[model samples]
Target: MRANVDFEDLHFERRPYDPQVAYAQAKTANSLFSVEATRRWQDHGIVTNTVNPGGVATGLQRNFTTAQKESLDAAEAAGVFTYKSIEQGAATTLVAAVAPEFAHTGGHYLDDGREAYPVPDDASLADHPHGVKRWALERAGALRLWEVSTALLTA
Candidate 1:
């Protein structure tokens, strides 16, 4: 599924819910938030980053739709990804939170304990399993997301 920031229907209130699409959009929004937060708060010494804690079998999966479960199973069978243990999943997040190399930097997508390489926005997840999509960190989209989110909150 393509990760998109649909400015008009961000909340999906007017859209049909496809689990993959909604998840992708939500993840993109999260990445965009980190990008915009870093840009706006760097001067104040705030740091923010996105972390991909790759597929731990947590309670979060309890909500997975049948299609989502089948998709994950298929991807695993195809060697695209493997589920990590909870501890392993948290390792990447810990790297982002406390690693010395990440202390002063922000807005990077970290996976498997390091900054993930950037892939084109159109890159297939099967081809770049550990990569971050370019659009997820687009500065202009981040800025616009920040503005739109602010307006929503204040409205």
Candidate 2:
């Protein structure tokens, strides 16, 4: 029942499948990967960052469960996010890729074309709509995720 970026139950082998929990875990993993990758490879000119393009009405959402769609609708209604066009969503990625400000910068999460504000790990989406949670940037968690992922790949 302990969701949210757990290494031991990473694949949900020990818990029921909850779409929201799975999505959250995946996002956390992405953030951790960026942090660890930057820490381990920045010296070699490699930069890694996580980007949240806000919500885009894309075909990918076709697979969304009813609960997922409802959650997104609620978030939108609460002003946590507004759906963006594909172009709008891609803009942030372009900024991360080519913006001089982000050049050589890594281990940061970008939202809406700039670095997202940092929020406490327990911060609610309603409180920090576009913020990056502290848990996502924790170095120890990032390192552990890196090691676990590497082991998975090698195994």
> Which candidate achieves the best TM-score against the true structure?
1
Write model 2 residue lDDT over 35-149, tens digit each, in one string. 9999999999999899888778877577678978998899789877689999999999999999987789799999888898888767776677678888888999999998998
Across 1-155, the per-residue lDDT of candidate 1 in tens digits comes to 67778898877889886666777788889899999999889889998999988888877667778878998899889888799998999999998989998788799989888898899878886787789889999999999999999998999
| C-alpha lDDT score of every prediction, in listed order | 0.87, 0.84
Model 1 regions lying over 4 Å from their true place:
none
Q: Ten consecutive residues with minimal summed lDDT in candidate 1?
A: 15-24
**Cα lDDT for residue 38, model 1?**
91
Please list the residue runs of candidate 2 whose C-alpha ends up more than 4 Å from where it truly belongs after superposition. Answer: 1-3, 77-79
Colliding pairs, model 2: none
Highest-scoring model, lDDT: 1
Candidate 2: C-alpha RMSD to true structure equals 2.2
Number of clashing residue pairs, candidate 2: 0
